[model samples]
Target: MNPLPTACKDEVVLTLPTILLPGLGIPASAWNNVKAHVPNAYATDRLDSHSPLSLEGQVNRVIEFMDDRDIDQAQLVAHSMASFIGEAACRLHPERFTRLILVDGSYEERRKACLRIPIEKLIPHATLRAIVQEWRCYSFWANELREIQRSHPLRTRTVVIAAYACRPGRWVRKLRRQAQQLSALFVPMKGSHRLMLDRPEAIAALIREDPPQAQRHDGYAL
Candidate 1:
């Protein structure tokens, strides 16, 4: 099926821009090589972890970013925490998205679903920042997790790509099966979770596999 378009009419973000997000301790530059392969992709920075958000806040941030770029509908590609961010966004607004290309998305799913500790309230703001500077992780913010869990599937075309060599053979198989159960097109690639840094062309090629219709294409008016 053809991919959807962004809400904007002018300043088209064509070539099926692959909106990319990085996991913890990673930076937007991780997708630089990947973006070099995929001309229209957009990857955000994770280095400035000075500010972080809850799941809802993260999703809203993505929506707002898309709004700024006039990207109404685009494929979501992310790793680790950022992968969850895109997933939460798709779950919240399924109609606004198309395909999801998740990398290491199901990383420690069972382990990461713990209760959120009110670290901010327990400790001083400066102390909290020093202790855990990064924003909301999977385990915290139980309410948002509940909402995502309770959410009905929007029937989005999902794809889950895993690291080919990260886990044991049995565990990897289990993860692949889990991806399938989640209704995602499972693909185990040859690398670690941070494969984007080493193999951008490979990642870009995968994204290009299902190109979305661009807003600036001829005869396809907004």
Candidate 2:
């Protein structure tokens, strides 16, 4: 395992994780391929069992973590629901972010709309089962994993990779509601959902191409 640099005292660059999933999944480890290209990158440590059930809570946690880590500014790359949090942070404090790469970002409005319907509501339950199921075959994650891939079909290489790391279950409805509020605030990524792991190469190239710029104090929502 590559240890995070200990003495980032002069300047520390942080990489925050996506919501409702661990770093081992989706964007966290997947981003390792492009780490060498980044100047300074440290994955946000797991927040206190406080999974991002809502965008605000997630963003707040991230902000607090940055304060704790003394990360004054950063280039954010968020996948899935976590993308919304990153956007919120940037909007809340423009000077905090150098640049943002929202991959496969599921906006608050869309996610709530998805949960409002009868079938998509299963996502919460599915997420729950996936997390607690002892037998992998019995896990709710398998079905949800299959559904996400089916709903947002991507290249086979990406599909295979995502399926391998899925840990599906139900996210808290309260959290889902928080995510919905974000719909009014930010624009959704191209794929509508699941963009990062699904299109790692593309997103990585985008991040690599856009060199970090000094952040301006003017707060703007994106």
Among these predictions, the greatest TM-score belongs to: 1
Please give the lDDT score at residue 162 for candidate 1.
62
Candidate 1 segments whose C-alpha is farther than 4 A from its true place: 1-14, 111-136, 141-143, 166-170, 210-222
lDDT values of the candidates? 0.66, 0.40
lDDT of 1 at 168: 38
* Distance from true location, Cα of 95 in model 2, Å: 2.0
Q: What lDDT score is found at residue 188 in candidate 2?
A: 22
User: Model 2 residue 140 lDDT?
Assistant: 29
Residue 165 C-alpha lDDT in model 2: 21
Q: What lDDT tens digits, residue by residue, belong to model 2 across residues 127-209?
A: 44332221221222223333443443221111001111233223223323333433321222233244444544444545544
- Compared with the true structure, model 2 gives a TM-score of 0.44
| Ten-residue stretch with the least lDDT total in model 1 | 213-222
